[model samples]
Target: MGKTTGFLEYDRIEESYLPVDKRLKNYKEFVIGINDSQAKIQGARCMDCGTPFCNNGCPVNNIIPDFNDLVYRQDWRAAIEVLHSTNNFPEFTGRICPAPCEAACTLGINDDPIGIKSIEHAIIDRAWEEGWVAPKPAEHKTGRKVAVVGAGPAGLAAAQQLARAGHDVTLFEKNDRVGGLLRYGIPDFKLEKSHIDRRVEQLKAEGVTIRTSVLVAGKDGLGKDSKVTNWANETVAPDALLADFDAVLLTGGSEQSRDLPVPGRELSGVHFAMEFLPQQNKVNAGDRLKGQIRADGKHVIVIGGGDTGSDCVGTSNRHGAQSVTQFELLPMPPEHENKPLVWPYWPIKLRTSSSHEEGCTREFAIATKEFIGEKGKLTGVKTVRLEWKDGKMSEVPGSEQILKADLVLLAMGFVSPVQSVLKAFGVDTDPRGNARASTDFSGGYATNVPKLFAAGDIRRGQSLVVWAIREGRQAARAVDEFLMGYSELPR
Candidate 1:
């Protein structure tokens, strides 16, 4: 608590964004971070709550009050150290995480929550500018080797931790570059790729070997026509890794996108959100793609009301689409949640992202009945209105309608990880198809197979990047203990 009365004296200051017109023309981060003074004011708003619910609210359990106090005191270097102590990559979460920590802030019960995410953004950016972020290589080699499959947040975190623990760690990625979904799934307008690049360099400096474009699979391999993105030029067998490395950790993402199997789903114009999103990201990265799915001059219909759907709307607007419409199967949530009933926890409420604000017509409680098309191409979508009562949904009589659409992007969330990869290593899986593992302190993250571990989306299903980092760190500790009979690495 830098200032006891600061919460009463300061109002929340939100981060600003570039003008929509100017930002729509390019794929770059548009958020204008708050200045140091504004960040200090925001930090000062952190109440000296006894419980510090914000810490528990954060997936990685960041020391929120400590960082807030540091930022309030203008201790930029210390602020970043505290941030990095919990989060391996604050830049990613600061940009994209929904900031549940703010929702659970003590001040939020009666007033606006402290702007923790903005303060974090300022701290990390300032640290980088001041050259405070640098490699902390291990003091001595442990003489052990570890193999981490997948180069996403979880894998990256695990590799960094294990390498810093003095173990030889090699991170394998199927894509030509690192960052599983972050590399290709998210639009650059939200998160720039340079952040991931610098971290990649840091990992190398820390003595973690990064092998991109390398697929580690079993005899079956990811099928030739798998929708999961793979750019691996070399394939390594699971057996080879088991023999070469002391332990193997699976941190791959949940790449199995849920599909709408309605009539005309086979239409050429209908595609998964993953199929359309990665292309634009690659193009933004200067990779020219022929026949890339574009929304230009077309009536675009994005099904699903989640973040992925919002991303489609933004990308479609950037592509200069004639019109962009988003559909949500569930009824719209309240504009505001009942704070008294849901305090100190994530509450359900309507969320309009920057992409939605840019331009999008959102339809809620609507379901697509069928895809209407001709000549093996999509033309329109048939829909029905829904009425919900007592947690059950029923179609409204005679509410069917046909919406004109040239491109239909299914932005529904993923169902599970690519089961093929889990099966390749003969690891047990939960009913949800995620790798089965426990998080108990005794041998946590260990799979049924000895010496094999799982974390992040591969183990817990699709989740926030912060959660991925937490799982990665804990999994690294588990692996360290398994290797050396005990570990000192923080979980």
Candidate 2:
């Protein structure tokens, strides 16, 4: 509402990226955020629509209009204030979130949506540069202890909120470092580790105790060769936490990677995206990884046409692969969605990520039939074309083919959280294997077990980071209300 005719006067300005050649040499963030003036112009494009669908569209329900107005008025400090009021970590979401808020923007019905994500990135980056982001430690300590398992965004948010609410919160992470997935799963080329480090320091300053490389599991303990990444040297029993902590929260990510069970899946070259991704992140963080999976000088085939697959393509390119190809089981979506029919909601459409643009041969409507290999090493992949009709898929006759693939990375999404953790806590789980819990205003996020709560992927399955933050904040409020009679923390 800062400028009524601004939408008509301004066109959307997209964030720029560093050249692929220059960026591929190193694992660092390449996104060039928009300048303040460009952000202001983008903010001006926010129409004064009576209904702010963007607010509802955003997982954390960020005050979009208020931030946009603040940016438009060149009030960077206030803009970040509004942004932080809702999102505990805007830097994370601003960099990686797909910006569902933009899809639901009123201006997007016909015109380009306002560059909300870019504005957010600019605001937060500016705030950090101006030293506006600092710790807000609780004024008084509550005589209660809380245990938060998993140091990902959800766990981080919950710990921050609970600590600010004057509770003694100890955040546990299975990995050697914090940031469950963000610390390892995501490539450093997309999000630098420094962001997570600073936030870790902020949490420490806020009086949240962080315990990394500590695994809290059931009596049996997490078995060997578990696909879930665990670098914990110390293992704490669930019973110990229940006895020491007044409340426990499970905010771990969905780490159960869906596998392709076709023949030759046992091939040495075939690996889960998680298996390959985390190694690179560790390497980027200066950890020495012997026999780390690399795509160098190999024909790489990444299965699954999702963000993870795109990430594989990018990483492969960075590894100097001979060739990179991506496969999608489903037919390609339309280049553009029908706005009239899908307004104010996420729509199905073709999305080409920066990784895809770098260099990738994308194959749609194709399924891998089998992995062809010799000497226990992958050599190629057999595939079949699919024809879809009425939501059903049938193989196309005589459409089989074999493609050279020295390394095959299965980038299909996660199915559920590691069951062992939930089992350790004696928490109930949904049919999908996610921890079963409700989001009702009263006793929300409470698991079947008393004094135990679940949020983020552990409860809702794999989702966007923004959704994880929302669940964490809401779960914190729920825990606060459970500890005290009521909670002043925002839900």
Candidate 3:
């Protein structure tokens, strides 16, 4: 531990945010990170519990206590090293991850948890400013080539690791820019695109070739109304990729958004969250969008209260929406968890995001019955109150109402990866429609198809970016071992 009584001596400090009025006027990041002194104080709060549940709580399994100690001692150089040892991109997680690590912090058992995420954020941002993050290209070539589909976190991490392992790696993305969901799905107010651009530069310097706007699949792979957003200008046949690469790894994320099929679903003002979110991101990236699905001056009703719904609320607020409300199907969780019972694990509790703080009316235990509109234009939403009994939900008698709305966004979670991609690769799928692959260290990440592997949401279903990075790095090790009978890469 940095201090013998650090946990008792210091309280947890949180990162600050810009005023709501100021941040709502723009589409830029607003969360202000802590300074060196604040970070040190937060690091000192680490108790260095014997079990170190924070490490396991983090999807990338970052060594929490060591970095906390390093930061506490002001050894920032070593701090970044320890931080990067496990997480390929701490900046990404530090910005958006809910920080399960904090929930599992031993200190959090009875008090506020150490601010591990903020410490990591400060460390990475400092490393970037100091030019400490440099690409380390391979010393020798393995004379083998690998194709990594989807230029998101998983694909990028795997490509970088494979390049460092001396394998020629090519990463493909259907979007015009890399960073899949990170590039398009997530709003700029959460994470700007420049972060992704910088990582792309490093990946290139490490001898990885990145190709954007290229779709890899056979004909009849994607269906009409599939809702898998694509900005591809070129399509490469699966056979062509198979013939060109020595091995293949699929990391394409789950893009099929879970949709609401209700009466008046085809109304003009009704749209998927993906359709609305990506347009704003594209506009922020300097793309000219005609007739954009905007929320300006509209009564926006966002369905399915989750992160995506929160994002829509933020984006809508930025667009000067007249009013915004969110609906959730499940009953509200407790404001605070029963820590004794859920320590060292993510708990079900109320999570009010920064967006919710800006402005939003959140209604839990409500279900949308239909999109009410006139002449094919959405005007309102018909909703009914729900009650949960014995773990089952039923409608409350005569508790139906119509909510005024000019626009409705379906923010429900994703269902599965686009089936065409899996069909093109002919990979087996688990019952949940994810790629079938075990994570057993001995033969992990490999699909039933020889020389083909899968990782990230495509293999594990919709998940956090940190988890995607872990799978990518581990899958790279698996690939290296398969190629040269050994690998020096860390898991």
What TM-score, to 2 decimals, does candidate 1 have? Answer: 0.99
Model 2 agreement with the true structure over 293-336: per-residue lDDT tens digits: 99999999999999999999999999999999999999999999
Name every residue pair that clashes in candidate 2: none
TM-score of each: 0.99, 0.99, 0.99
Q: Give the local distance difference test score of model 2.
A: 0.94
Candidate 3 regions with alpha-carbon error over 4 angstroms: none
- Alpha-carbon error at 410 in model 3, in Å? 0.6
Tens-digit lDDT string for candidate 1 (37-105):
999999888888899999999989999999999999999989999999989999999999999999999
lDDT winner between candidates 2 and 3: 2
Q: Which ten residues in a row have the lowest lDDT in candidate 2?
A: 220-229
**Cα deviation in Å at residue 152, candidate 3?**
0.6
